[model samples]
Target: MNIQLNQKSDKPIYEQLKSEIIRLIMCKELREGESLLSMRALAKDLGISVITTKRAYKELEDLGYINSVPGKGTFVAKGNQTMIREQSLRRLELKIKESIELSRQLSIERSEYADIVEFLWEE
Candidate 1:
């Protein structure tokens, strides 16, 4: 699944896993109905705990990004674009809010912040 976890990251492993899976789905690398590895298998592959994989899978399922079938396996859910887009926007908004707070603390002007954003957007 091309999932990568950073042990040194401040984010939890399960959150990283969830984000990677979502990124793959958003990038069309994981199509609708595509089966995912079992939680145990993924934990072994990623060198993480089964509990971590379970938590990630549960969150993904709750978010409508994937589905679990008893005795079967997990598969990507269909028609989840809207949900995915909303989630992405929420994350971006949170990040922007943090940046705005930091800029205020540093006395950076709004125009300068906008310029930086524009430069990054064009990069």
Candidate 2:
């Protein structure tokens, strides 16, 4: 798994890490049941505190993207198809919302926006 952190970005370090990990999982780069590095190890690798990594893991666990097994380690959660679909849909919805806002700001016609969406969808 590859994650790049930007200390200069407005986003928090932990949030950036969490988002990259989620993206990896969604892209199947990190498969189900694959073990993740320990919080300390990840923090060291990213040059951040363990607390930041722990928070990211905790949030991922709460979202059902991963789970922790006692005495073992953290692994990607088993198939939660419904949850996964919901997450994917949420991301699509947010993108659509942003597109709508931008189109409105640019005074783009509805039909033109629809054509753009359809064109992208077909690609």
Candidate 3:
């Protein structure tokens, strides 16, 4: 339950919170059925409103990352590797595409780009 909130980020606080939780789940830092700190507790810890944390948790549930019980608490949803892979690949593809576009904008030659990728690939 380690989440960092930045007041100046372009992304909304709830969205940032959602993304960080998802990353933690994908990295196996959060395990299935593991309980999360209560929304009120998290809000107090992060110095944010409880409603904001609720919205973020709601979205995480919507995304199938966690499950909420009526009077209990939120727990990590069971991992589905296929689902995780699809979600993860979508994020990664966008990042790689952005990098490629930036490289092209800088007028880097194709050969130089390929060589650089190859170097990183072996590392």
Candidate 4:
């Protein structure tokens, strides 16, 4: 719930909110079945519009990351491990691809690129 929005960034506010929530869930900061702030409350806290929080929450629910209960509130979904894992893998793959492209641009050897990866992994 310790979200810091980059108001200067080009990304949409709702997307930033959604991504932070997802990051919290992935890091186990927000555990399964944990209740989240209501849309209006979150909007007020973040100094954003209620519609922005609503859109982010709605998208998260559609993606099975959270669930909303009438009058009860919204809680993290309990069975999204597979989806979360897949999302993590996809992000890793994208980073790897970007590294590979950078290496190619710099004419770095494959072994050297891999060594950098290994070093970073250990750190």
For each candidate in turn, give its C-alpha RMSD to the true structure in angstroms: 2.9, 4.1, 4.2, 3.8
Model 2, CA-based lDDT:
0.92
What's the TM for model 4? Answer: 0.73
Error of 4 at 98 (Å): 9.3
Report every candidate's CA lDDT.
0.94, 0.92, 0.87, 0.93
Q: Ten consecutive residues with minimal summed lDDT in candidate 3? A: 79-88
Q: Model 2, range 1-123, lDDT digits (tens) per residue? A: 699899999999989999999889988899999999999899998899999999999999988899999899999999875778698789789999999999999999999999998999898
In Å, residue 22's CA in model 1 sits off its true spot by 0.7
**What's each prediction's TM-score?**
0.80, 0.74, 0.72, 0.73
**Model 3 collision count:** 0
Clashing pairs in 1: none
Measured by lDDT, the strongest candidate is: 1
**Superior by lDDT: candidate 1 or candidate 2:** 1
Worst 10 residues of 1 by lDDT: 78-87
lDDT of 1 at 28: 90
Q: Rank the candidates by lDDT, best first.
A: 1, 4, 2, 3
Tens-place lDDT per residue, model 3, 17-79, is 888888888787888889998999988989989999999999889878889998999999876
Tell me model 1's lDDT, rounded to 2 decimals. 0.94
Worst 10 residues of 4 by lDDT: 79-88
